[model samples]
Target: MIPSFLVPLMGGSDVSPSLLTFKSLCYFKCSMFFSPLGMVPVSALVGFGLFDRGFPVVGHCVEIEIPMLILFIVLSQYLKNFKTRQLPILERFALLISATVIWAYAHLLTASGAYKHRPELTQHSCRADKANLISSAPWIKIRYPLEWGAPTFDAGHAFGMMAVVLVSLIESTGAYKAAPRLASATPPPAHVLSRGVGWQGIGILLSGLFGTLTGSTVSVENVGLLGSTRVGSRRVIQISAGFMIFFSMLGKFGALFASIPFPIFAAAYCVLFGLVASQGLSFLQFTNMNSSRNFFVIGIALVLS
Candidate 1:
């Protein structure tokens, strides 16, 4: 629901090309900016019992996640050659296919009672079917403005949220820069960025009014997807946004996706997030690596982040 409203809103930017040239310093600074954001999924993988108390753990979600990771990579590689006319459907949608296959496998395991005697956390994270969410969700529910309650503000919370918004802006900037490069387009001009930020602010306003948990920002991970699949059509994104909105109204539909095993998502993230990190580093080619100043700046930024 949040993404459905947010994506199109953010996409509605009025960008005008500029006659000015881009600066190398700007490229250098933006290059490694997304490195930290890219590694967030790796941290999530670790939290999913990949390691326990600093020691490696096995057979928790390791069994499922390892296979899922490998499968996604294999499918993506194999599908790269299989195309229909001009569109590489297999390659472009490899992520979806891999996820669907693995999810079905997990569902089979659940039906076989594989997790019946496991710990509560294991069952909760690995199970394909979540009866509670499905049962609790209505068949059709439309979100209304202030549906949760009337808006309230606090000085302390407002300050903290403002900090988060600042971070979100920085992340979105990196995403904006990366998207053009991934799509084989020229870097966005200053005016384009301003327009994007303006639209993002409007999306955030709508998110608050719609009772979303967080405001909208350009998704860093999806930028990686653009790099991976080589699909950069704005119409595709708008269609996806429409699906999100449709699913939001169908309560059970949303709950169905929520029930996908957590480890499966983690495995997918492993591939996607790694690509994001690499994409950030790829920008280094545009900078003067021979310069000591550049190295020092990169080191400091990475370390601090």
Candidate 2:
């Protein structure tokens, strides 16, 4: 129920597991969507379970899903303490609903008849062997509210995609900034986190153009690392990033990275993201949202659902 709103969106169908996975990729954009990474693994498991019960779309999603999920969990947690000024409840709700509606709209408009189709959105392109991507269409495709949209790689769309990249890179920047400090250094510089986020932006924009979302960084696991170590130094995280760069250079890393269990990461991430959000709420000056006036504002958000 944690993903209470998402269950019905994918629309269950009775079919073979492979077909289900195909359907999922086509419609859900699963990995490509770059959702929280936590919820995704869970949704895949559910889809797989459905496939086992004779549903469809349960192929190899779990194989490639786990490590990316772990990375996502760790990065999300690491950023738990970084607070942007809180938006009014009405604003938050508006943003959430608007995103959902846009996703919904995109899903329907691009379908081929009743079956969603996007052969270009496959996972075949994201493996580490590739050198790079120079276009932006791939990144836009990842926002797969529904996979049926006609995701293209034409250079004509680059202008609009550049704008999208600017925002996605901004988000990537935020995630990178929230990681652990490395080494014996007590804390790292604000610039280091800034640079980290910038890296995240560049990574995703390029990868996204290839119809992938693999380049984004930061993990939620570092939250548990944070809660245990009580350290938020940027130096330590930079060290960790260096290590990742090293491991990534190894050919086998991609295979090994893909084998971790999906459900494990998703379940842990669900808890981690909620905690991160709560920690953000802890930043409020008054910490007094229970008042009648506050309730009215919060209620408006819930009503949109």
Per-model C-alpha RMSD: 8.5, 20.5
How does candidate 1 fare on TM-score?
0.79
Give the per-residue lDDT digits (tens) of candidate 2, residues 1-305.
Answer: 31232222222111111122222222222223332223222322222222221111123333233333343444344433444475233222322233233334323433322223424332332122122222211222223323443233333344444445444433333233223221123333444544544454445443443344333444544543443345566697789779775665554554444433233234344443443333323323333545775556444532441
lDDT comparing candidate 1 with the true structure? 0.64
Using TM-score as the measure, which candidate wins?
1
Q: What is the per-residue lDDT of model 1 for residues 1-305, given as tens digits with 9 covering 90 to 100?
A: 32244322322111010100121124334434444334233222222222232112124577567778788888677657787897777778888888898899998999999999999978887888887888898999998876766555444544565566665555656677767777888877656765676677666666766757666767655776877788889999999999999999999999989988878877776666666666667767666778897777666656555
List ranges where model 1 is wrong by over 4 Å: 1-60
| Consecutive 10-residue window with the lowest summed lDDT within model 1 | 12-21
Per-prediction tally of clashes: 0, 27
- TM accuracy, model 2: 0.37
